[model samples]
Target: MEKPKEKPIIELKNVLKKYDDKTVLQNVNLVINKGEFVTLLGPSGSGKTTILRLIGGFEWTTRGEILFNGLDIKDLSPHMRDVSTIFQDYALFPHLSVENNIKYGLRLKRINLPRESIKPSIYKKQKNLQKKWAKEAKDAMKKLDKIQAEYEKELTKKKLPKNKLVKIQQWLDDSDFKYASWEVWPSLMNEKFEKKYLTRKITNDEMDKIVKDVIKLVNLEGHEKKSIDQLSGGQKQRVALARSIVIEPSLLLLDEPLSALDAKIREQMQQFLSDIQKKLGITFIFVTHDREEALRLSDKIAIMRDGVIEQYGTPKEIYDYPVNKWIANFIGDSNIFEGKIIDNDEEIISILDQKIKYWSKYKFGQNEVVDVLIRPEDIEIKKSKGLIKGIVETIVYQGSYYMIEVKHKQYKILVESASEFEIGQKVYLDWTITSMHLMTQEKEKNKNKDTVSLNLKLNKEEISNE
Candidate 1:
């Protein structure tokens, strides 16, 4: 048997958020395992950034639990949470030099919290756990989970009563100790002792070492003395990243950090960020509206729409098997249509005299209408003998390759070809059976706005005179 998958470093369970009367996010569920590069991708106002804020503890869910290392962290504050976010606007201290900014979080002194203000719900046991019971408590918390999982499986097999199920759930939620708080001085004489104990700061040598190492990590070793104003946009972005990562947070959130950079620099930073994530083995939750950027950088992508995750999977899965027409159009240039499947075999699929062939992953009845999507690059254009002949409408010279638009009476197809083809030139467009993606016909009927599907419906009568 295969080994079980490790638990997520951070998890959002049915998270929902509301701003005044507006529900920004509803029933959001996401899991990010350790060291995984996951991206939340969507257009603006789609709530992708809101998800990052939730993970960073800058925003809280209106309902549902946020878990860190299997423990519920619904009550954790921004500083208390072990997460760092790099926003679009670097958020660096204007007066600090790059070296000081990178070392800022690491050299921070202890946060002075009054003992009474720290509630049980907002506390971590590490701050106050007794020395003798600390190890035992930690082991128990970790070990009990696996044991409970096994027991739950057995219970499911036995089909236990509802009351027994409740009992098991209660046992799982039970904790040996609750709340974490700062200790107060018992008497006037002990006040100085409390200040000494509570006030903690890193050594000068340690801060120096961390700043030096992180500066090197971000490829800004020599430029450590430079202020924010002295650095370029990309350099400033690097400094922001170094600051977030130097403290070694379990999860790193990047909210469109590359948005301000030019295309070339953005590409460079993309590779740099990905390489760093791999080298450090830290989980990255990147947020971006640029579909290509998400596809290029993320190991897994969660596509959001109007505060909900429309689909979540690998890039290949999302590309080859889009769950809907909207997703098919968003990621790439696709030719989507409601086509009729005529036949299964060679030329037997001929209708009237047009032997058009389309590939489908699912088996549908002959003569059944279905929704199909095929990428422009997937289709090959041939000057001579090809699958379907069409009149070239236009040719776009795209640096590396030519994009030729072909019109076949009612059908318009886009093909990425190596060679250039002139306007009104006759060409053949072809694709392998696997290149076509199919969706439900009923869903296609629901499309009110024909976006990608519009390229095919131009008036042939209007073009006849031309």
Candidate 2:
């Protein structure tokens, strides 16, 4: 799909929001570029919902700037911000039909969107500019003529040569010489339209065309007249999406929209949302606790904890290279080893007490205390020569695979495999070189700040001696 992306469409800078005596959000900073699918992945009460409300202008930020398209939107209302949200409950009208529910935003009472008129505003400006431009152009030409005559008089008085006149007419002769283009005037954008498509200004034909197009986009073409009570959970979800999308918002917020659907239906809607985001090429911010759903639907992921973002990166980066033990425990399943780096090599690291050789994808300093992470599926238990000896402590059957817990001294390693090993059986634990993830502890990671290099000036004595 062709995504006609631009610079950041929404920015929340140092945003702090509080509800009465409680602070739900604090020092939240984020930038969402155009046409990117971003997910806010975290558990409940992590301030994901609060972020959406702030972006939608439903709730104002207590202490920071909310910018839309590089301009501060502190005074813009929800209707003027051109943002749309689909909530967890779908938020459809129970008494209305699917078509009417889709039309709810167009209805005068529900959303009350103002109409956008492009031509009349631009055309009026163009007309006024044309009138204004004529006098300016005439005055400029007259000034040029006056300068030319003065130069000629100077030339006659001083008896100068005709060859010195080349630089005087540069501006008059240059067609591409730039004056402030009329397009950038403060009045170019129409304030009366309110960045909306109103019901009153739209004719019945235009309204029907717009409503039908959005319904077709949501795949509700034949079920327009069907009542909301008559539709399935998936259909109702789509109706909610259609209602939000019909207004053509610059940013779309989805707050656990598939929480009500069955597993299979929810999976289907995940793909549906991804496809729609690509097809529409609009910035989509999805909020959900489901890790798999967020990984599957978003291009970037922001993981939050206790109303703060713990980490933000691509899904693969979050899964493979978690910053701290807390994030490793939250994002996916893994076995962790707490040991000091005894020997660092080109491709391996030896942990002294563990008597185990780690398959290192990163280099660690000698004697550095760090954590090593290995996914459960990466561990290979077999009779072949292995890195360490382990005793199988427990076996768990998990449908497609069996999870085996092995105890090696002070560490308990988890491994996932198809064959179940007997409990208390001695087995060899081994893993590939590329599968191990080395991480710095939270405090250590924070201590590694970005530094800049500078060039020093030599002293005057040294310079004189040189």
Candidate 2 — which pairs collide? 114-198, 115-198
* Cα lDDT, model 2, residue 196: 37
The 10-residue segment of model 1 with minimum total lDDT is 180-189
Looking at model 1, the pairs that clash are: 120-179, 123-180
lDDT of 2 by residue, 29-98 (tens): 8888898899999888989999998888778888887787765665554555778899999889998888
Cα misplacement distance, residue 294 of candidate 2 (Å): 1.1
lDDT of every model, 2 decimals = 0.77, 0.77
Q: Give the TM-score of candidate 2.
A: 0.73
- Candidate 1 lDDT at 154 equals 61
Candidate 1 lDDT over 1-466, as tens digits, reads 8945866888889998999988889899988888899999988998998988877777778888777766566545444467888999999987899998888877643434566765554345323434325555456556766777776786766678889787877765652222211111122123333435444466788778877988899999789888889999999999999999988887899999999999999999999999999999889999898999999999899999888888899988888888888888887788876766678543123321355765655677777666678788899888888777899998889899988889987877888888877999888877876787776654433234585356445555458757
